[model samples]
Target chain A: MSVSGAVSEIVAERWVERTLAAYPAEILPFLSGEHDRFRNPVGQVIQESLTTLARELLGAMDNRATAPAIDALVRMRAVQDFSPSAALRFIFDLRPVIAEVCGEVTPQLESRIDELALMAFDRYLACREQIASLREKELRVRALSPAR
Target chain B: MPETLVQIEQKAPRGDWRDPHVEFRKGSICYSAAAKNLGALSLPNPRAWQPMDADWKLPPDWKRIVLDGMKERLKKYRSFRLFMDICVRCGACADKCHFYLGSADPKNMPVVRAELMRSIYRRYFTLTGRLFGSLAGGRELTEDVIKEWFYYFYQCTECRRCSVFCPYGIDTAEITMMGRELLNLIGCNTNWVLEPAANCFRTGNHLGIQPHGFKDSIDFAAEEASEITGLDIEVPINRKGAEVLFVMPSADYFGTPHYYTLLGYLMLFREIGLDYTVSAYASEGGNFGLFSSHEMMKRLNAKIYDEARRLRVKWILGGECGHMWRVLHQYMDTMNGPADFLEVPVSPITGTVFENARSTRAVHICEFTADLIHHGTLKLDPRRNDHWIATYHDSCNPARAMGLLEEPRTILKSVCRNFHEMPENTIREQTFCCGSGAGLGTDENLEMRLRGGFPRANAVKYVKEKHGVNLLTCICAIDKATLPTLLEYWVPGVEVAGVHELLGNALVMTGEKERVADLRGELFAPEAHSVGSASEASHA
Candidate 1:
């Protein structure tokens, strides 16, 4: 495998191991599908894709990549007609998902994951509020328009 | 040949010899047996119904202005966004509509109905529409589209029944509101709605009827009340320091059945000896039509607070109108905050206080009447209502919108001995519209009216056929006006009356015998009181 590919696999393997360790026995039934990924020979493909996507999000150099991720989240939410409250609730759930996957990695990386998750959550909240204000202003302007 | 006398005699037929159906047909026949038994009450003709100079001219860059405005609003809330986006275009909501079931028009389909606004939002705001345009079925915003929006949005009563059945809980009422707000942005509003809204903004009533005219109407009603109750009680208007501010729709000042309800309130107030005054300003308590446009609604409601502040009244009593009660129950308190001076209504007679005080403390007329009856404040003769079998038609504004199902029925049952109910869905929160509600109660939209009113008319028809329900009682002014039109087309023989009309009939006035004999010659008797004394007694 290429060096970058191998690095991704290592990161994903570390993540899965930490997830299994951190999760309580009560949640074991829900964790069944990913167990095969850690044990089987074909697990690398699934592992590489997830880790690469996470790494890309984490390593986003400018606002463009972050924006696309935000947009994707918004679009998915819009399609489901999820309220801003519901969307924020989902963001809260993402913290535990990240912690379960990466807590056993280097403490530095675990802390970095936590910080990144928080930043994204704050950004999403800001975007939602901005959108809501814009909408209200639009309603007022439309209400006053002459052509209707 | 005095013109006023000729008009009075021509417009006002003698009560004793009039046909109930023909009396209703004349439109000017103000007194029925139900109203006469309560007292002689009459609403004033605003006497002036002129159109005002409105800002109908569109702005120079109107298209850009309206489109941008709609996009901005659509982008604001996740709840609105979700509702707008997730509609699957399923025709399930069509048959569920009283209008659609009545009219059988595909445009009445709630999904399609909402799409009138949804498609506009899509074209202006969505990326798919911006990039693909016509390929994605997006059309340019045109005058015709605006017309369609006007036509369909007003067709809705904003009843919200279809929303209950929607899997996604998508409210078409919200969509209709947005559409109307957008339409008003470009001066595309109808004369019937905008004129009334504008008049209410300026003159404190929808018909632009001034204080003198209002006072005259009240004086006439007070005279009628005096005739029946033998009490020289004045129907006070804009009287300062009154304990209660009696607010009702301007239509009640002139509409039949409604006029009697107004008198019933007056008589009950006098009987209970409560201090009250009707506002010369803020004459209307209902503005469900304004729910579609925030600006117009805010402008209209601004007077209520202003008038209350001016009069310094302690509490406001809302009349028996559906949409008016809904607006007061749900949004009025939120839109116009708490009145620190006012307390939740506590009955002077019974010492009972209204419990469900939200932001603003307002009581529906039925609640007030029901409480009075519950406390044994008023003497009733249930036998007076026994002339014909009767059933209740639930007005949409008070039922599903406000959870006011029991109060009206409770009052009706307590007053009327022969009162029967329609099917379960035909009453309560699941009740059908009279089809002429929301501002669709106009004469111009006959086809749409026929369609939207069909479901309600059909329900009334079923009751009339199976149960011999001759009198259809509801507690709304709009129903009184519109149901007559619908009954004419669908159920020919059934008649509609206000809940207060029934109560007025059953009210045991102190000097009814002397007043009845005195007015019997001047007023025709046979047409007014169709039900014989024996029939009334049997049910009593």
Candidate 2:
């Protein structure tokens, strides 16, 4: 179930392809083809680096490693001002890509990967909700302070 | 020109007196009699009220004009675009609205309130709306819808309390501003709001009460202040190079009870020996009616920066008014900027800097007083305010909107011996409007006034019935004018006064002995503050 370096690039490239495919025909012309020309390669490198960091950070259980990786991913999206709904869209877009790229693997491996994706999405959602709550609290404190 | 002016004056009715008591209330106290008889109050002269002319239609291309203007204003901001785009229509903000809570009306729902502008935004700007039309909840703009927009948009106090609970962080105040901007593009503005804005544009004050009237009002207030405190307080006006410019709403200049708070400011400034001057030109700081439109708001506020420059004041002290403070705190800096001549005000008495200041180094009157009290420069006899159970109504501007909740309370607690807060939800950011704020405080809108004022009046009534609270204290000038009218309608016996009025009553200064008779009469009843022993008092 571990995504090696070659497997990570294969997964990311499939994600980008699937995301570009989901747009309606009218919006196809507006799609950037790449997320951002300058950021895409660097972003993929950082995302993979963080996945390794999450594995090292979590140390023992593979299920536990999945949660930390998803948490880190959610934190990254929040720093970019991505809402939970938008985060969900990004995850959903990656699904068809995962199926297409990982289809030739064993059925058992495919089910394990699907389970990991679902678990990661749930953890990402929980992190997004936590971030949103913190943001709301911060806003309240700023509003209640004398010097708003 | 003179002939036309004379003709217009002749056509305008000369003070129609329907009921002398009503006339007395409006003319002297500025208490809108409409607030008293909420459901049945009639216009002062029905003849004077006319529907818009049949030919008065918006230009055929009004939408293009408004959208172009909005695009130009919003071109630089990506966040504003996102804010406009991301509303999920969950009804959390509906019950949280003070107006909706009071009125129980479906249209007053915050989502619907915001949708007045949002629908228009979608219709004109979004691809979904351009494709789907009414199915996408986009409707064509018509005169009727515009009128409804005006009615509900003006109903909002722009208090921003609803934004606190909004799941999307959607600020209804921003939507209200956009609504006002669009309304202004078509010239469908109220005479009360537009005329005052026009007056402020031309004469630097909303009332258009000329320099002589300004002087007269100030001198009269100073005389009253002198009568209360034995000091001959002089309220200097338009004096160049003054250290501070005291800008207040025009209502404070002419409105009763509000005039008392103005006098309190005068006495405190004189007592502390601060170099300040009132601007004869820019007399009003609050534009409650500007809740309707940004153009009207900008027109009214245009004088503030210019007047400060003309007077060469180092700092401006905003009077205790609700919406005015909201406008000043929220948009003054953004709308009128680079006021490099001004510095954030350091209290002359305390030497403490006001850290929460925005745009042109303005300070609220209560913040100024709290600082003065902190410095120990303001002589206090807190016992003077002990006769009545006092509760503070945190005006919406200073509370949830601007976060100026504590400074006023600090001053009140220090000055008043017995100070209490109303229920928890009824104070600080959750505080209710005095029903008459955001220009609905006028006599013309009786039903709307009752709906808006009900929550605030009910809260004050609850405290009064339960705790024997007789007086409601707030810092805003509009609160003084409007709360009294509302209390008369709902609570019947409760009195509302400015926080500074209580401070003035408690102030102990040089020649305090000579003013004891006047102070005792106003501050305490004969039975409450008898000087003689109990047996001697009984005999007397």
Candidate 3:
């Protein structure tokens, strides 16, 4: 792997660690155990899901699966009443975290992360659109049926 | 000295950790349902906003509306009254909760979940609570508290597993239902559930499949069933005077894994030549309203009996679904009818009577099929499913609510050779929710679903490692949709399927050709069969 690719891996792990650190430290360890069933296991599931998305996002891989993963993360964020800045910031928040980890990086990685932020914004908007459309469905489609 | 059970258990991942003080966080909270869906239901005080919004725009009379709603519900449901009035806080139900077990959130505990409402019930209804206030575990109903109601209530799947261990039989499902109903009075309802209920009310199915579209789906399933069996079988749609009116979850007709289960029903009905007719008007057995309010549940459920009487069917045969049975078995007769117009359901082919469902007079498909298998009505080839080591997931509603456990397993044992149960605690009445039932199965709530579904998945992982069990057979439509993603994310490659789907795969339909693939659409080629069997055996 290229030096930057290796750097991305280190930064990605650091970023996931940093993002998880944002929550209470007490609950952080349970994040990866898939079999940890309980009430409101949502906390751990979100951490693990975001961790995967962060790693895959920072690596800047062109895998198609990443799109849905990104969409899912944003849907979770957008549905909550977070400010647009706070909701989308997790993707862009990688910049400072990555910089602090890598010490120094080329503009290519930086620009790529910026592009991902834009994609994250678009995906977030799409989730909002879905919510809006579903809400409107009751009124607009009462007479005419919408195809599943 | 021998190592004790605790020491041995401590050597691995501990399942019994207890945090004495559990705190709440925004982490696992669900997004607020949009205002329009609530307005569509004509609920009072609807407004557009998110759960995190600073202002919820409550009507001036919101408090009165809620208190009045509570007053009315208490009178209507004796269980609600008894549950509310009699709770000694035994703490027996705390660890028993899958959500509390999975997340360690105290509020997720059944007692704590009820306390959220019971505290309010105390604040207004009780003498000591009103005087002493917080000291008496009572609090005034406020906006933040309303948000808490939405968060915790929607968080619950209303599985009712906690009710079993409770000394008072305090059903949290009833509390959760009442919480949701109270929320609905104020126009707080989730769109994922409201949309499906509305669709079912209008189109007779959750997916909103109109009569023609419903016919198209049945036609397609018939074609595919023929492709597998080489027997062209046409399913009846909306024909009167049919002996039985078959009802099913609409997801079976539309969703991928679920559609395969639909194919199973088609094949099973054909094999017995059952005198049944599918109705366009009462097509849905899965009631999304069960996730919402009682009135909505009744409105959505009334169509089934109405269509049955119109079609002149003597009895009803419900398909493989979890919560659908909860309604049909427990609530249907009370909410919908005397059903005196219809006769007791008896299998014409097997000569077996469903005495358990004598009052409701509706037979679960598993019970019906199990009876047929016992009577040797059809030849089942177990080797056809030699590749899968299956474990049965007793979905929460059917197992706990109605006790329809052994019927599915009996059918599975008859059809599939390699069947195992998950660890005893996780099966039967103690089953975990798919994490996304009761209307929280939307994309937005994916994180919550994954976590809530983790305990069940964790138990599945245990079996997968221990027994090499690859197939997780369940009989819930919500499980069909949610478990696939939940299991795939947590324990990949272990899949979900309905019991009927497996039976369809194993059934040697008369005059049928060699099966090319199982119901999952995986190739069952002769060459792959030996290799698959060898590998699957090694897994066991």
Model 3, B1-540: lDDT tens digits are: 666522321111222212112222343455555565566566666677666667777787889999999989888989998898898988878756666655445577788788889989888878898999877878788867787788888889888888888987788888999999998887776677787787788788887889998889889999989987889788999889989999988778877578888998999899889889998889798998898888888888888988888988999989877788888878887888678889988899977888887878798888888888877776776666778899999988888888888889888887788888887778898787778788877655665665577778877877898899999999998898778767766677798889999888777777776665897778653543432232222211
DockQ of each: 0.01, 0.01, 0.06
Worst 10 residues of 2 chain B by lDDT: B19-28
lDDT of 1 by residue, B411-443 (tens): 788767666787666567667787667676655
lDDT (tens digit, per residue) of candidate 2 on A1-148: 5555556566665554443333223223323332331112213323443445323322342655555555544443432213345544545444455557655555555455566557657766664465355435434532442212
| TM-score of chain A as modeled in candidate 2 | 0.49
Best by TM-score: 3
- Fnat (0 to 1) per candidate: 0.00, 0.00, 0.08
* Candidate 2: C-alpha lDDT: 0.62
Candidate 2 Cα errors over 4 Å, as ranges? A1-148, B1-56, B66-80, B517-523, B526-540
Across B299-412, the per-residue lDDT of candidate 2 in tens digits comes to 567678788888888888888887777777776777776577787778767788877774558888888888787767766666556676889998887787678888888788
TM-score of each: 0.66, 0.67, 0.76
Backbone clash pairs in model 3 (N, Cα, C under 3 Å; residues 3+ apart or in different chains), count: 10
What DockQ score does model 3 reach against the true complex? 0.06
Who wins the DockQ comparison?
3
CA lDDT, every model vs. true structure: 0.60, 0.62, 0.75
